[model samples]
Target: MMMRSSPFWPLFSQGIRHRVLPRSSLLTPRRTVKTLPSFSLENKTCVVTGSARGLGKEFLTAFALSGARGACIDLSQKDCEASIASIASQVQNAYPDDPVPELRAYECNATIESDVKSTWAKVVEDFGKVDVLVTAAGIVDNVEAENYEYARWRKMLDINIEQGHFVLAEEGREMLTWHNIQGSIILIASMSATICVRPQKQAAYNTSKGAVQMLAKSLATEWGPRGIRVNSLSPGYMKTDLIKGLLENEGKELVGSWERDIPMGRMAEPHELRGTIVWMASKFPTKPVNPA
Candidate 1:
């Protein structure tokens, strides 16, 4: 399989969309988003795909801390349940009386329309409207570009690109008839979408994210009319199992020393990505409005 190269981006940004989208196109009389008010996630329900571990786990943590009733969905069903159990147990240990997040786990394969539909049916049955949708479900392989496995490469496209589009499309359909409420959708991309990965075979993985970047903006345009905000959150390399072996090779010289190359002087921590997810996912405020 021949893999196409990816370009750097803010795929959420439509060249001509400052007018229709929920987002402000530029600095104006109103405060910039940077200076905008922070909203609470208390009692709001959120769903995170691929929430069993890694970036998904970080998203779980962020939503939990922000007071969302979070549901962690993953193809690895058992592992997903274990993660929820562990997090719930931790909160029980740390804060006995406070309201812990109403967290649930569901086994879902985003690539399968049946799974996406059924899982979402259950999720909505449990928690009414899906104000936020975060699709982190993806897989990676380590085959050389020239010798990438045909089967693995195709499967990668199924999970990474198709699954995202399928889930987003499904969610958009549901949100359309929703009670005029606002919604947010976020897809996770990678730095590989910008820089060409090297020294290993990740052509499939890189290509998937590259495709996802554009899919997000197209959705933003279509769904913006319905008060939906769709965006992509791209991450730099992080210390996750996908790249653990590649980084941990005895003398790779990149493993524990990657901070040397990062402009911030450090490999990303699990907590680092959470802030962005939480900010974008939970956009509603919880407080009494002050009348001027």
Candidate 2:
């Protein structure tokens, strides 16, 4: 048999071939392997918006349980303190031996771009760097389209779509790129983006969520090559204070109506979304999940 050089032989020991791979080729291409990354948030720093209550507060607890330092960014300082305390208590109860992950609260109005930027800067200053960003600040306007005023519609878009979602994505991308950190950004969208809710009309809220879903998809395409992942988690109705008033007014009838529509037969709890949130923020190999 005659001897011939094989292309794959480059993978062999350099001592044998007395050859070195080009720096670009060595660093650019990664081997494709099937292995799940550890779903641990140990020592990671996360910045979460709208952490005062509801799903945002639940995320804070999840972060604490996963051993992540967190910055709870909400509109009210008092509310943020309450959220931080809640997370701390959960960590103490769950992992008594382990030191509770640091949790700080920042009063930030996400609707203001300057406030968002400053709050993120403060988070970076305190935590060294942010490993994950969660945009969870939002509001729902369940008013009839006919009665919806121009100001209300604009305000809804301003807060729900632009400040709460777009601004966070922009700032997070900047931070990730600057730090050269392969981080994840999770935007909170809603199932209403895909399906209109019955018995109530929230056109502004639905439209805002739909826009968020699209924004996340667009950013995923733009940022995937840069090692930063952007994903939008669109959750169904959840049992949280955000919708408590409406739930109380409608009582069991509306509850039953929504439950019948969903295969789960019930609304999700705030804690129910924690696992998915952790997975998204983990080192797992996850592609950008638009409307996830």
- Give the Å error, residue 44, model 2: 0.8
Lowest-sum lDDT 10-residue window in model 2: 1-10
lDDT of 2: 0.74
**What pairs collide in candidate 2?**
none
Task: Write one digit per residue (lDDT tens) for candidate 1, span 175-219.
Answer: 887555577788888777766755555888889988877787777
- lDDT (0 to 1) per candidate: 0.67, 0.74
Candidate 1 has its poorest 10 consecutive residues by lDDT at 16-25
Cα RMSDs, all models: 13.2, 15.8
